[model samples]
Target chain A: MQSKSNNSLIKVRQLTKRFDKLIAVNDISFEVFKGELFGFLGPNGAGKTTTINMLTGLARPDSGSIEISGLDCSKNPKLAQHLIGIVPDESNLYPELTGYDNLCFCASLYGMRKHEREERARDLLEKFGLSDAANRKFAGYSKGMKRKLTIAAGIIHRPEILFLDEPTTGIDVASARQIRQLIANLHDSGTTIFLTTHYIEEAERLCQRIGFIVQGKIVRIDTVISLLQPIQKKHTMVISVLHPDEGLHHKLISEFPEYSIELVSKGQFRIVSEKVINIGPLVRCIEETGGEVSEARRIRPSLEEVFVNITGIELNAMKKEKQKNGRSS
Target chain B: MKRWIAFWNILLKDMRAYYLKPPNISWGLIFPVAWTGMFFIKSGKGLDSIISLLPGVVAISILFGTTSMLAVTVTFEKKNKSFDRLLLAPIPLRLLMLAKTSGAILFGSINAFIPIIIASFLADISHVNWFALVLAAIMIAIASTFLGLFIAVSVSEVFEAQTFSNFFRFPMIFLCGLFFPITSLPIFLRPLSYVLPLTYGVDILRGAIDKGNIMPLWLDFLIILGFCVLLFAISLKNIHKRWIM
Candidate 1:
């Protein structure tokens, strides 16, 4: 019998992290493949950031093992760190230094030569569209500018793996889009990206595989397609008719038994079907029932719907739960 | 070589930040100069005695300036969490402590000369041995820098460091014979003054100034060197355990 595991670039086994009686990460085990865009999805206090901290050598795990690029993190932290680049949740940039200087400092910490560090700093600044603000001190930079520079700094050394915590939390739409594009570009260039974000849309767009963490445990991990499968199987279809047909709703349900239909008004009906492919059958049934099928289209469930279904609560509700837990304990 | 470069970077950064705001420099020099000036005005009996006392007084002022300034600055940095950046860096803890201590020492050495120059203009201290004064100033720098490192690592807050530094500074100023002769103190108190590191430092300076070798030069040097080594070891150990985390 062969072991069922692929070549893992980053493997975490039974990792546990606790903060003085509060268990932040509870024996979580996972593997990240080479050149894969993995999304670490969870509401706040789900141990995503704590796991990242342990992986990056900023904090020590209470037990278990973390191996990056086949090197054990506990045995050789510097070497493991060299293989990973991290953009922490908080902006850890040096406020006294300029945007260019912060990047150079990071490069130096990684033992890059002065001239090479300078060139890479300049290149990253231009790539992040921060060249114009390169000379400005970070203390004065806007939030978006600061976040962009931080991302540039993290990738300055071109580490094999990258960890981004909430890469686009409070930015304008255009800047968030640009950041998303940058991440996608990096992923294309063969960098394994591990990202944590509350933005479900970002995970839906970028992640090849995502893990859903709830209360310090990974509740689920799968491809975005698989996680949305249950929701996708049932789509809401809104239909409009030109004339009022009293028996149209009854006729439509009897004719298309696969679809569950509800009449909102004299000329409108709400249809929920088990498959998107059944939308055609439902439209034909509405027309056959002496009603004009106007604006009949399948509306698939969104990431929000999937999240709510899996977690059994909205994002705000989860946050309130976390806050209450924080206050009480 | 890498250690030296890291140390130089830290030292230069501190110097740049210190000079960026000139008030620190002005305040550091003002107190010592004012004290020297008052002593000159009060002591009209002998020009030679006043001249001989000038270097010791200046050395004492510099020692106080460097140690107290470093303690305050380090405590503030620690409290504000700015020191975490340096502590988390790849540089060794000892090198960081040495670099910060040396920066303050360098400033103290420079500020020590201001009072001597001012005194030279007011009193004819041309007869005093300038070579001895330089040596005494160098010793003062080493001793005070270590003392500052000890205080910086041991204390957790600026106000606490300041209060403790002031308590020690006042006694050293009077009892170490910065302004008056150690012989003027009572016999019981005189022995206590001898145990202080600043006492031998002041003796060396005064000996260098007056051309009167009262204590054995090598003995004084050895005692001061021993104090510096002890303070440095304690400071490095404490900083390594606390700051490295």
Candidate 2:
């Protein structure tokens, strides 16, 4: 990734958007510096998409100001549109056009010359692993191919900043991983990105700084390392055992008083502690109690824990939404 | 320079995605000829009356072609959110909208000629003012396309667009003197014909084809031009209010 700079490529302040009685984005403010991958981390309806819409001129804000590369876009939101690219939550390219045509059309909208757009489109198709499908109509592309082409179209003009609204929400794991890698490559090449996603792991893996927003309000904004600082000292482990019962649970709780132990399910238990857990004594105690430890694994503290702690929303809720979005898309 | 490039690209995209499709192309061709045939049979007028029927047939063809295309292109794209991509383009909203409507305008203008071409072979249209006819066809296309745009902007669904479009289109077909002269209408309904832009567009077409204009040629052209601007302005305002917000 490119080294972070102090130059702010996007600055939004006191931004508020209301739809009838509901305030979709309420008084949110943040800055994304040049070449930084800034994640607007939020669950469903947390104003992440709404904020991106306002910034990209897709929607107007009821109040507040937005400045892109020092150009005031408070009233005329399209002033900085030339300097930015947006990949909407859904693939918005023409379904009838071929992937190559879609990219060339988008580049043309950015005023790229014919030869330049065709070359760029070809390069993007190859880079996105879509050369094989270049001539196929977009309607025939799989979900993953559609998304990759959408990203390629977003960057066809090499805009200074890119706004990605849930770029990999519903794709398969392999495709999602490939997209993340591509996004990292884009960041490495020095394109500032404003990414929004409900996946805490995605934010943890990619973003330099993260902002946690919930219910149309920003709860916290900090560097990923700083955000993880509070949970860094804690350790969590999940152990699966055969013939687990309440007796073993109570005994383990009493034996490991310093650790928080809970029976997660029929054959599993979880143990969490602030200090590094010593497995020898805990395993020996369980074995002595005639319980067989089948599998024991350590869980890493990640942005999931930080998000839960800061926003007080259950991770299961996010997972349910992920599944919902996955099915719908 | 960049704005014009974007505008041209957007227009080309719409042509490729919507206008030039085989279904729409065949529909455009068949609909105009079908409408012309239906009017000819209904009027019980032989090929001898083809010149008098040309103006009304051309006007109706452009009206339906433009309205139906915009109904599909604008409302469907808005529903699927592809129009949002165009909205994000660096071009001004006015230019963006103009780019979007251009394909429909071109389509409608071409549709206007189908009947003219058919009529030219059957009737001696040698005395017709070809320049005035072409200009009238283009102006009629603009007015009707903007009317389609206004309908598309006011509604959210494609079905709603069709219904809303019919609310204006069906009335203009009779009230605009497309089939009959506005002077022959009841005085009470005469004002309604004047209020519809298609009336002036048909008048210009009638003047060019049959020397049957009630209003002066310049006045008819000016009124159609005014209506185009008015409809376009209203559509743009509605787009910002309903779609952007």
Identify the leading candidate in terms of TM-score. 2
DockQ of each: 0.15, 0.81
Q: TM per model?
A: 0.72, 0.95
Model 1 chain A: worst 10 consecutive residues (lDDT sum): A320-329
Give the range of the ten consecutive residues with the poorest summed lDDT in model 2 chain B.
B42-51
* Residue lDDT tens for model 2, B1-245: 88888899888888887888898888878987887788788878788778888899899889999987887689999998989998998989999999999999999998888888888789999999999999999999999999899988888899999898899999998899988888789999998888999998898888999899888999999999999999999988888888888
Candidate 1 residue pairs that clash: none
By lDDT, the best candidate is 2
**Whole-model lDDT per candidate:** 0.76, 0.90
Chain A TM-score of model 1 versus the true structure? 0.79
Instruction: Say which docking band candidate 1 falls in.
Output: incorrect
Q: Which stretches of candidate 1 lie over 4 Å from their true place?
A: A1-9, A75-84, A223-226, A236-313, A318-329, B1-7, B18-21, B38-89, B96-102, B120-245
By summed lDDT, which 10 consecutive residues of candidate 1 chain B come out lowest?
A: B81-90
> Residue by residue across A128-172, what tens digits does model 1's lDDT show?
899999998888987778878888877888889999998887666
